[model samples]
Target: MTGKSLADYQKEYERIIFFDQPKKDILLAGLKAEMEKQFKLPTRSKEWKNENQKVIAMYRKICITRML
Candidate 1:
């Protein structure tokens, strides 16, 4: 994606995280899917990689693991 769009996505991500519109899982999954879907971009751009890693880490912290 272009730098402008990337910046816009980041801004949206921040708003969702702050105001809790997406509730974490949706945002992370959506972002990961978007990142994977756009894998044809040049290898030099690690932006998606960084974003996925961060969101995965955050998910791991709060997500429930064991079935009730």
Candidate 2:
């Protein structure tokens, strides 16, 4: 694996670790605020439900076919 991808994953792991250990609502709110500012997104996009259902359906089909 390339060092670039490893660095990316390490960064993600550190963010997850911070979220788990802090368990602070204020900290989580700040993170969300920053993301919204940087991405110019609503942060809680209404399309998430439709998007989630599509992703779950894709996974279900894959698991069903692969297990057969």
Candidate 3:
């Protein structure tokens, strides 16, 4: 995804985390799935690999935070 779209998704994720009233589990699951789907893109470039790693780390952090 482009930087703008990624930022948009991050904003939505923050909303779900901080302000959404219901179905947080469902929304988070969907977001995780979407990120996994996007990560299927070939990681041939160093820059792409770095960005993908950052996103995966972010996902993991979200999961841990939700569990806590």
Of the candidates shown, which would achieve the greatest lDDT relative to the real structure? 3
Would you list the clashing residue pairs of candidate 2? Answer: none
1-68 per-residue lDDT for model 2 (tens digits): 22223234334334543444345334444444443354343435657636555433433433343333
Regions of candidate 2 where Cα sits further than 4 Å from its true position: 1-23, 43-68
Clashes of each: 0, 0, 0
| Cα lDDT of model 1 by residue, 1-68, tens digit | 34334444456555555534356657655654554455433234567657566444433332331110
Residue 26 lDDT in model 2? Answer: 47
| Model 2 CA lDDT for position 35 | 36
lDDT of 3 at 23: 71
Clashes of 3: 0
Q: Report the Cα lDDT for residue 19, model 1.
A: 39
What is candidate 1's CA lDDT for residue 43? Answer: 38
Runs of candidate 1 exceeding 4 Å displacement: 1-4, 19-22, 40-68
What would the per-residue lDDT of candidate 3 be over residues 1-68, giving only the tens digit for each residue? 34335666687688778644457766777776676666654346788777677675667765765665
Q: Supply the global lDDT for candidate 3.
A: 0.65
> Each prediction's TM-score against the native?
0.39, 0.32, 0.60
